[model samples]
Target: MNVVILSRQQAVERVGYSLGLDGSGLNGELSPALVGQALRRATSILAPCARYELERSVRQTLQPLGSPGDVVGPMVQDVLESLIVYRDLLEMRSTADEVWASAEVTIRPAAPSFVKREDGSIAVLGTAGDVITPIPEDLPARLVHRGALRLLVPTSAEPLAPRLQEFGLVELSEKAWLRLPRVEPAGNYVEEWHRRLREAPIGNRPEGLLICKPTRRGTLYRDRWNPAEVGETGLFVARRPQRFGANLWCLVDLQPNSTARIVDLFSTGDTLRSCDVAWQIQMALDARAGLAQAFRCRPNGDRSTIDFFSPIPSWAERRLFLVGRRQAGTGCLYSYEMATTAADGERRFLRESLWLVEQN
Candidate 1:
């Protein structure tokens, strides 16, 4: 019983696209539109390396050819090829979700769910049941790289090994589970999160999510003439034993209908002044967005909101910034909204918010 779902039109569209027939219309051997969404996500994860390659190529092309538009075409085409597999991959996820909801299956979050520390004690979590009675010394490598030892996805109630083999170990399964190194939230941070949740006003719990120590800071500004430092902006949270704080920023290029938004919230002993985090937000608001201009936010004491001239439409380019320190477990966030044009002429909306979570 192979319960896979697919649209013939999508396949035809993708095939045509994969063959470099971008403007050949949808009546081809493949359907790009049908597969475009999944392709984008899968290619994003699997061929993320391609992005670096494309960027490198662009840099080279720009210097010799000096035409940004000319270089963009080839780079975008390369990205499209790398992402075509996303269509099937997304279908798989969708199928798995439906199957899990309706079937008699108990999926464990972690598989081979036990590991032995140096003390020779076992650690197990999830329903897989002390999978490794005697922990192996090489267990950490497997845990980090191998992902769940088993999965009962709906398409097949079988464990994941065979599927992993088919998908290509390094490309599909391994990269999907590679965890970005991040700082562990401190005990004080955990307590503060609890306090915030506990003191939530009847219906006013924090509406967005917060990630602590997301990544090291990075900037997109490559020109020396550009005043912004490449590593000086981003989104991140700083957490301490009993407190947590957020510093959000947006670098230069603020224009209309940008897809990115910035919000900074933190719990600190020292009171926050507008001067501390406002400049970062100001940068985001000033980014470029084709013809549309971004909404500006003015900080009034402790709170502020951005009222845009109009919402950024879908499929717009957006840049986001997040910076954090693992040792200190603190950071900031930045976002940018890209300008988009609708095929049918519609409005754009690019809005993002932030929130926090506590560890159990």
Candidate 2:
């Protein structure tokens, strides 16, 4: 039997038809313009590397089913081709480019049920009332990455523990996990976090021992460099003791529904803007607080939240914590809960756990 191989274009088109993209429109044929538009959007969202990844995923999924023109070729082609379309949609909706870059996109014919990792990786959590088998290690990098992070696998998949361990991933029963590095403390420093909490007008300070403090404050959105016109404000802080870790806090005014910078940040899918905000805050903090040494900061996790739709008050606050420190071969972990309340009585809570370590 002579096996018929599929060209890359044919494979992509077959996948598109499987995804119902071919005749979903008024015309019986899928528009080339539509495919081009989707491709352009996917490229914008995933960068040029997306094509490489998508092609790889398609080949991997279809290789086991047989040749393109075999008895099961059409069935396999549909499955593989739909994945390509699904990848484009997922990329379009995703907010973080780094997460999408690291993710191995997959789709099952069945319903969706999965556990999401702190770093944004996901694994099947098993379907209700059914024992689910573990996915093969053929796509291990997509499903798991190197790190001492927690996992959320189902009981039925417990048999795959050895393989998961070999891959450097583990499942934890604890509800919270931290992945921060550690660093040596500077030793000489004022207890600014303690004092500020005592003096803050936020009523009675919560009783977990003040471990962090804001080192500086500035406006997140400003026009014409006028401090008086600054409606949005941000704060910066380094994790206590070790001067290596830092955090950023921003309070944006959402008044008159026009001055809301928080809305602007959430709409553009440019969440990296938070990193820029954090860096600016860190620089300001170092200059104002006169720290012994300035520790370099970078984003550690894919955890972030935005709530601007509910009947918000005149302003909203956003915070980013960056920790990179390690000490004596042990990683340092920090946990905190941030609570923000709007003037109109809307409240939101953010729980954070990060590991601190030095940058290599």
Candidate 3:
């Protein structure tokens, strides 16, 4: 069956009715003015994504009248389409004192959409879908790690790694595993980590350590580390520990420098699994830092990933950093590493980099 796509106008009208706009205005039909008002309202909400803002606005606006009828489904679809049309016009404003303070920013596509020119700066595609702005050569380092561009792309689309490689922009990949250092006992750093862990707010606390063992049941390997296996065993250990299993043992050691080291045995997992580990650690760090709408990347590279992360207001900080800046902005760069043992007992190391970009 062929699918039907709604035009931008139809989408706006459908979304209006869903939000209880009544479809009556100066023109007798859903006026562009009313649709514009609703769009502005959704923009004000500034959800993690445009779709989220539409759904939330619909619910909040209609809540007083009670649940919406069957129109809710098509209305959501229409609102989403409208959001895409206005994406370029939507500005993400930051309250940060340093750069981007009170400045409105727009979300620009990255990778295949943006490319590096010979001058070392990146060429950004204009609204007309052509390269117009050339990001300074020095700006890539600042932007790659600091500038927030949604890295997640659809699997059905082309893989970005190859395109990035053409421009020497593939900073982290499967090969990054070669440069990671071996994990060792944290020693005195453990005490300092314990103190920080205690001082951290209860909501940000990480769960107890997880231990996993790998076993070979023919050619396939299965992990035997289940939370249930921990049983009544205490997570906190004061001294050096021996192997927890015959083939694989995983240990998380916290250091005084606000870093964690995860030691694992049997590290033959694929790149996808390693990415999952990196994403998990990034989420934990974002939560601890009180950043809202943290971007979570799937282990398998696919189109399912969203391209942006947003920070919500917390109790202490009323304003959020909306742009990428070196000194004080919402953009942050983080790296995580893990050491794994091979079936032959040879240790292999892996590392992954994460960028959390603030969005409207």
Candidate 4:
């Protein structure tokens, strides 16, 4: 896919300019500087000023480019740039003032004659297909780490070293294992955990994000989460994506952002059984994917201004990014994973939702 940014004058109206990249928009009120910084960051990441092998390196560069008043203006720019790899598929992850979790869910495609409703919603065509429903109005727009699982860390010389070895755990030389005190119900528990971590007294120690998994194998429920599934009883930790697409379709992001990470996982459905990182990312966003439709990415503005030659609203002034694949026809099967974090250390995980099986 190709992307073109606006010129200097358009950049001024579209994104403006900033000196204190970090501090640009820190005031109680929003300002053009802040807006510009965001736009610039979005442009750099979505469209990308540069691409690098390691995302961490990109973050290092961006930490200094924060908007005015933000001492880290230039650095932030670098970080955003590092995360630009996912710009093509609209799979950029972001962790700014708010966290937005989204996915593209696909059902079997129908006949060509099927039509979308006036409001831009697609419907099932036949009386038999009538059982199919439109996208839910209250569809979940975000994914939160509702809870975590904490397990006891054996304390001894060799301790659980043998178990770690058996499980292929990669031991971090000096980090101490903090026992997972207990498991709580899903509602509001994550916020409580984070709050407690923030208030931990001096000398108190904790390591890594508190991960929650299944406690038992059979039919699983949220409240009765089993740790063995999501966490490592050994030293090695398993990473998973929050959503996914099949080989035929590419995953796309509705909103683009800087510093996003994409990955791939196993499995064809929304269930969390098999997912992982360390795979190729899709670099094209299929305009026909559910995500594009959900984000209203298609041109919907007045016909006179349907500027296909111009940048779309999603990429006009801010950082625009995407990640996914491109293949001929449909009926392809691939998997992907992604995550995003902000300058403030906020993080968002994109777990694979389902496989995208294109209809012929």
Q: Positional deviation of 128 in candidate 4, in angstroms? A: 42
Rank the candidate models, highest lDDT first. Answer: 3, 2, 1, 4
The 10 consecutive residues of candidate 3 with the worst lDDT sum are 315-324
Task: Report the C-alpha displacement of residue 19, candidate 1, in angstroms.
Answer: 5.9
Which runs of model 2 end up more than 4 angstroms from their true locations?
Answer: 1-10, 13-159, 167-360
What is the TM-score (0 to 1) of candidate 3?
Answer: 0.22
Whole-model lDDT for model 1 versus the true structure? 0.26
All candidates: CA RMSD (Å): 21.8, 19.8, 18.4, 26.4
lDDT of each: 0.26, 0.28, 0.30, 0.23
Runs in model 3 with CA error above 4 Å?
1-41, 45-55, 58-193, 198-360
lDDT of 4 by residue, 246-348 (tens): 2211111111221111122323332211212101111002121222111111122321111011112222111111121111122112111112212111111
Q: How high is each candidate's TM-score? A: 0.21, 0.22, 0.22, 0.19
Q: Which tens-of-lDDT digit does each residue in 26-134 have in candidate 3?
A: 2233333343334444544443233444555654553333232334434444443333322212323233453523222222222223433212333222122232112
Worst 10-residue lDDT window, candidate 1 = 319-328
The deviation in Å at residue 124 for candidate 4 is 29
Query: lDDT per residue, candidate 2, 213-290, as tens digits?
Result: 332222122211222122322332211111222222232222232232221111133222333333333333333454
Give the count of colliding residue pairs in each prediction: 60, 20, 3, 80
Residue range 67-147, candidate 1, lDDT tens digits: 323443444443333221111111111124453232111111222232222222222222212222112333322222101
Evaluate residue 70 in candidate 3 and report its C-alpha lDDT on the 0 to 100 scale: 32
